[model samples]
Structures are given as C-alpha cells and as structure tokens.
Target chain A: MARVAIQHEDFDLSNEIAELRRHDKRVGAVCSFVGTVRGREEGTHGPPVLSMELEHYPGMTEKAIEAMIDEALHRFDIFGVRIIHRVGLLAPGDQIVLVAVTSAHRGQSYQACEFLMDYLKTQAPFWKKERTPQGEQWVDARVSDDAAAARWGIPGGNG
Target chain B: MKIAVRYFASIREAIGQGGETVETRAETLAALRDELIARGEPHAGALARGKSVRMAIDQVMSDEAAALREGAEVAFFPPVTGG
Candidate 1:
C-alpha cells in the first residue's frame, strides 16, 4: 500500500488503520486525525458554503508528502504511516483528509500524528477553493497554522 | 538557463495559464521572478512583490535565495490552504 494517497475517492478509516497494524506484532498504539469540510469556516454567521473544490500539483504533491512521512519516521519511533487526502469537488460535512500512525508506544504515535498534520497544513502543495452563495473564493492560509509547524522546529511559514 | 515554470491556485487563474518554458539569465529564484514580472501584464499583477507567493524547485519547498538550474522545474503559488 502507498504511504501517501491523493485522490478523489473517499477513504475508509477502519480499513486503513487496520492495515497499518495488521502484520506488525510490535504495534501497540494507533493515532489518527480526520479533517472535514464545514458550512462556514470563519464564523457561524459567515456565508454558508455550497461546496469545496480542491486543486493540487500532481507530481509535487505526492513527492512532498512522501518526504514528510520519511521525516516523521526518522523523528518518531513509529511502525507505519498512512495519509489520504481527497481532491476535486466535495460538499459540506464530507471527509477531506486522514492521517494515521502506529507505534510501539502511545506518545510517539500521538506526537508524530500532530507533526505530520502541521507539516501538511503549510508545506503540502494543495489549494482549496470554496463555493458559497456569493461565489467561489479561494481559502486563505492562516498565521496560526504557520505557528503550529514552527512549534515542531520545522520552517514552513508560507503565509 | 532554461526552466519550466508552473503556477497554481489563484496565481494560475490570474496568469491565465498553467505553465511555460522560460529562457532567462536569472541566477536565482528571486531574479527569475523579477524577470517574469518585468514582462508586464498578467505576470506583474499576479506575482508582484509582497504578494505572499510561495515557491518550489524540483518539487521541494524553496525560498527566493535558491539558485536556478538548467532544466529545473519551478512552481509559484499562493500559500497553501489544504488540511
């Protein structure tokens, strides 16, 4: 199985997690994160979102994610990692991303999961454009996300 | 040197094209950007200075200081927003 996947199809969390720890006897912990599209991003009173269209640099997207997974493995004592990100058109409440890690202990997997997510937020070459009643608008990168990656001693401030 | 340049997201839309091959005397990424901006029109407006543009070379995140190489693949885009 590929450690990183960028596709238009939805992923099954249970199946992915199970596959991560399947043949590994040393696996003692599993940690995962899921991201979803919401009706409003800024505030509850913000314009209701109709859908989200995602764009990615095909060759670079896969290469960048694979490199980060290698970084995660080097930094943490993790047994496996699986990341899936959906692209194309998606509606509110639809699943958007998944990051899962397995390790011999809970702490490593937990930390690695967050680290990978932070890295993905800023470093990955994916763009999100939202459709609302007003029209389509590209989502802007947040400063907070930059700070999140910096906390891990990673330099990924693209904002 | 000649390089393949790619643009994404809003930058791609603003530039009105996805990519192009440029023949330039630029020694660095910053210089290459300036050369493009000097072309005027769509490039100057879309990739103007202080536009919060991000760059990559050979599929790796890079800064303006990165040196240019022949046959390199360079990309420009706004800051990423995907989760």
Candidate 2:
C-alpha cells in the first residue's frame, strides 16, 4: 500500500490497518486516529451541515504529508505510517481523515500518531467548504490546531 | 526574471484564474507580490498587504523573504484548514 493517499471514496479502517502491519512482526503497537464530519456547527443553532466540499492543492498536499511522515520517522522509532485524506463532497457523520502508526511499543506509536495529526492539521494544504441551511461557507482555521502543533515545537500558522 | 504565479481558494476566486506567467524584476516573493499589487484592480484588491495571504514557492510553503529564481512557481492563498 502507498504511504499516503488522497481520494474521494471512504476508506475501510480495518483493511488499511491490516495492510500497514502486514508481515511486520516487529510492530507490537498500533495507534490510529479518525476525524469525522460534525452534523452541527459550533456555537450556532443554525441548520446542520448537509455536506462538506474538501479542496486541496493536489501536488502540494501529497508532498506535505510525505514530509510530515518523514519527520515522524526521524523523531520516533516507528515501523510504519499511513495517512488517508478524502476530498470532494462528503456528508455529515462521514469519515474525513485517518492517520495510523505502528511501532515496537505503544509509546512511540501513540506519540507519532498524534504528532502526524497535529502536523497535518496545521501544515497540510487543504480547505473545507460546508453546505448548511445558512448557505455555503468556507470553514475557518482554528487557533486550537496551531496550539496543538506548537506543543511539538513546530509553528503552525495554518490556523 | 519571469515567474509563474498561482492562486488558490478565495484568492483564486477573486483573480478568476488559477495561474499565470509574468515578467518581473522582483527578486523575492514579497517583491513579486508588490509587483502584482502595483497592477491595480483585482491584483491590488486580492493581494493587498493587510490581507491574510499565505505563499508557497515551488510547491513548498514559504515565507515572503524567500528568494525567487527564474521560472519558479509561486502560489498565494488564505491560511489552510485541513486534517
């Protein structure tokens, strides 16, 4: 399996994890994260999000994620990493992203997993536009995501 | 030097095109931006100094101070929101 994928189709978590760990007996721990679309917008009682349209800078998106994985490999003793991000139109409750990591122990896997996610949130070049009862709106970047990435000493200005 | 300028997201929407080739004497990303802004109208409005614009040089995220070379591809857009 490729280390990174950007597709419009929903992914099967079990299948992806299996493909990542296949024949890697040295991997004793696996950590994964899945981000899903929320039905409601925060702080607004407005109508639910009917669908979300994800847009990205194609070549740059893949390159950025690959660089993040390379950084994780340099910082941790992980055995494998897989990241999948979906684009195009998606409905509420649909999965949006997945980051999975494997290592000889849980410590490295867990930290690396979070590190990749935090990095992706701030550094990756992707945008989200939501269709709501209020009409179509582009989602704004969050300061919290920058803070999350800052914990790892990386400056995250995407927010 | 000649360079390729690209726009994305809101900036793309404002500029009405994804990319273009331009002839410029600007030696840095910031200077190139200023050159475009000097063109007036859409370029001025979309790339005004106060606007929150992010840039990438040769497909890698870069700051304004980054040096520009001939035939480099530079992109301007708003801050990214991805997971």
Candidate 3:
C-alpha cells in the first residue's frame, strides 16, 4: 500500500516512516527525498525571489499524484510509499516536498523514491510565484522537467 | 461565452492585469489565442514571436488546439521553473 498527501503544514518524517513500516515487516529499507524552498529560483526568467505563492487545482492534484504512485508501484517492487507536498505561501528553507518509499531492499526503494520525485516534478499541477526584492514574479516552468518525466513514458509532462 | 482569462509573470505586468473574463464566440483554444493576440499592443506584444508561453484550461495543461467550451477558465503563463 502507498500513502500520498498534499498538505500546507510541515510533516514528521519519523512518524511517516513508522506508519509505513508498522504492518510491513519485510520492509528492510526506506528511501526519501525532501524538496525545500531554495533561496534562489533557478531557471526563472525574472527577479530574485523574496517569497513564493503556490497554487494547485485541489481534487486533481491528489488524484494525479496517486496515479503516479500507482505507476511507481507497478514498475518497482516496493513494500510501501508516502508522498507529502505542501502548498500555500512558502519561504526559502521551508520544506515543500517529501517522498518516501520502502522495500525489502535498498535498490527498489531508491528507484521508487527517485521515480516518485521525478513524476511529481513534472506531473503535479502546482504553480509557484516568487516575490523578489526588485518585484514579484512568476517562475517559468522548466523543459528539463518534461524530459525527466518522459523517462517514464507518461503523457502531459511536456508542460 | 464568457471565459475568465488569467495571466502571470511578464505577461501580467505587460498587460497590467492579473485576470479577467472575456466574451468570445471562438469555439476552440486556437481561435481564442488568436483573438487574444489581436487585442492590442500589450496583448500582441506579450504573445509575440519567440515567447515561452504555456497555457492551462480550467487548471489543466492545454494546447492551442484544445476545445473551448462555454465558461472555461483559461490561464496563460510563462514556462514554469518550480520543482
């Protein structure tokens, strides 16, 4: 089984790990990735970021992420998975994303963790707008993200 | 039909508005884009050649050929760089 959550508050990694491992005794390893709000908005075509406002289409975001996790489970042999993404006003150093996957071995866990992050990077509908010292600006979407999602052969990543 | 049009980034600044609803008879996204391009210098200039623009209809990524129904929300933005 897998757990996917998109929240506006911070999360406890230890708690999520314990929850994922509670029933799955065969889980021998866990792999995780946390995306933080960086001080600089890389690849943006505008001013530096003072702050960023994140927006997402409510029902669709969760559904898309769940489908992505489902695909990850089908492609990789993993025991459990958990994804936590935060929305709303986020400042630099704030934890914005979390991905965790567990498997009997570290290999599968690592692959699954990477796969989930890649999928979220391109597939998720969230958008970010940064407020720079010069002026407020919206960040441009990256083409590399599309290429990253293409590795999985999923559609709609080209955006 | 009345469709709410939203703009972001340089386009928003160039146009001096965040979003607005517009009445149009265009039945497809392509026609709507053309209509927007013809609006004025700001709209025309912002959407001019070599611009890296992306669009979403009702919050989903959409192409120029995507069908436009009545009252759909359309958004135009520059490329997204968020992770």
User: How does model 3 fare in lDDT?
Assistant: 0.78
- All-Cα superposition RMSD per candidate: 0.8, 1.2, 4.0
For model 1 the local lDDT of residue B22 reads 99
Model 1 stretches with alpha carbons more than 4 Å out? none
Looking at candidate 2 chain A, the ten consecutive residues that score lowest on lDDT are: A39-48
- Superior candidate under TM-score, 1 versus 2: 1
Q: Residue pairs in steric clash, candidate 3?
A: A50-A131, A140-B79, A140-B80, A140-B81, A141-B79, A141-B80, A141-B81, A142-B80
Candidate 2 chain B, run of 10 with poorest lDDT: B5-14
Off by over 4 Å in 2: none
- Estimate, for each residue in A2-105, the C-alpha lDDT of model 1 and write its tens digit: 89999999999999999888989999999999999998977788999999999999999999999999999999999899999999999999999999999999
Q: After superposition, how far is residue A104 of candidate 2 from its true place, in Å?
A: 1.2
lDDT of 1: 0.95
lDDT score for residue A88 of model 3: 86
DockQ of each: 0.88, 0.78, 0.28
Q: In terms of TM-score, which candidate is strongest?
A: 1
How close is chain B to the truth by TM-score, in each candidate?
0.98, 0.96, 0.91
TM-score of chain A of 3: 0.90
